[model samples]
Target: MITHPKPQELTEAVARWIEEIRPSLDPRNAFLARVAANALAAVTRELTMGEQAQAAAVERLEALLGHGGTYAALNWELCEELRAGQMDTATPGLLMALRANVLDQLAIDQPTYRHEAS
Candidate 1:
C-alpha cells in the first residue's frame, strides 16, 4: 500500500519551507513570505478543524431555529430571523451559539487573536 501526505500535512510543510526561506528574501519579499506562511497555517487549521466547526455550527443553528437544514440554509434563515426581529439577543441561545461559531472560525483564521472573551 502507498501513503500520501494529507492536505494539512502538505500545507504545514509548505508553510515551514516558506518560513525557512523567508529570512533570505528581501524585506518586502520576506514580509510577503510571512503572509503566505500565515495563510497556509490558516488553511492547515481549516483542513484539520473546519468540518467539526461547521457541524457544530449547524447543530447550534438547528437547535436555535427549531429546524434542520444545510449549514448555508440554516445560516441564511438565522440571518432572516434576526432581520425580521424574530430572534434577538434575548433569544435563549442566540448569543451563545453565535459566539461559539465566531470563536471556532477565529481559531482557524487567527489563532493568536485576543479579545475580551478570550
Candidate 2:
C-alpha cells in the first residue's frame, strides 16, 4: 500500500523545493524568473484584489441603485457579476490590471529600478 502526502504536506514540500531552487534558478534562468515573478505577482494580485474588487462593485452598485443594492440583491454572483458590470469589458481591464498589479508587486518585492548615467 502506498501513502500519499497530505495536501498541506505536499504544499509545504513544494514551497521548500522552490526556496531551495530559486536562488540558482534566478541567476541561470531569466525566462523562468520572469515567468515565476509574473505568476507570483498574479496570484498575489488576485488574492489582494479579490476583496477590493468586491467592495468596489458593491460601492458602485450602491451609488447607482441605492445602498441596499448588491451582487446578492441584484440577483448576481460575486466575480461574475463584477466582471459583467465593470467599466469597459472586464477582460481587457482585468488582464491588464492583473499584469500591472503583479508587475508592481514584483517591483516591490524585488525592486530593479535603475538610473541611467548622464
Candidate 3:
C-alpha cells in the first residue's frame, strides 16, 4: 500500500524545501521565498489546528447564542449581537468565548504572538 502526505505535512515539507534553497537565491527571490515559506507555514498550522479550533468556536457560540448554525453564521451572529449590544462582557461566556476564538486564530496566524507579552 502507498501512503500520501497530509496537506499540513506537504505544506511543511515544501516550506522546508524553500528554506533550504533560499540562501542560494538572489536577494529579491530570497525575500520572496521566505514569504512563500511563511505562507506555507501558516497554511500548515491552519490545516493542523483549524478543525479543533472551529469545533471549539462552534461549541462556544452555541453556549453563548443558545442556537446552532454554521461557523460563519454563528460568528456573524455573534458580531451582530455585539454590535447591537445584545451581547457584551457581562454576558456569560461571551468574553471567554471571544478570547478563545481570537487566540485560536492567532495560533494559526502567528503562534509566537500568543507567546509574547501582550
Per-model TM-score, in order, reads 0.94, 0.32, 0.86
- lDDT at 19 for candidate 3? 98
lDDT per model, in order?
0.95, 0.51, 0.89
> Candidate 1 vs candidate 3: which has greater TM-score?
1
> RMSD of candidate 2 to the true fold?
10.0
Per-residue lDDT of 116 in model 3: 50
Task: State the lDDT of candidate 2 residue by residue for 89-118, as single tens digits.
Answer: 444444454444444444434446453521
Which scores greater on lDDT, model 1 or model 2? 1
Per-prediction count of colliding residue pairs? 0, 0, 0
Model 1 earns a TM-score of 0.94
- Every candidate's CA RMSD: 1.8, 10.0, 2.4
Checking candidate 3 for backbone clashes, the offending pairs are: none
Per-residue lDDT value at 111 in model 2: 45
lDDT score for candidate 1 against the true structure: 0.95
Give the runs in model 2 whose Cα sits over 4 Å from its true position.
1-29, 65-118
For lDDT, the strongest prediction is 1
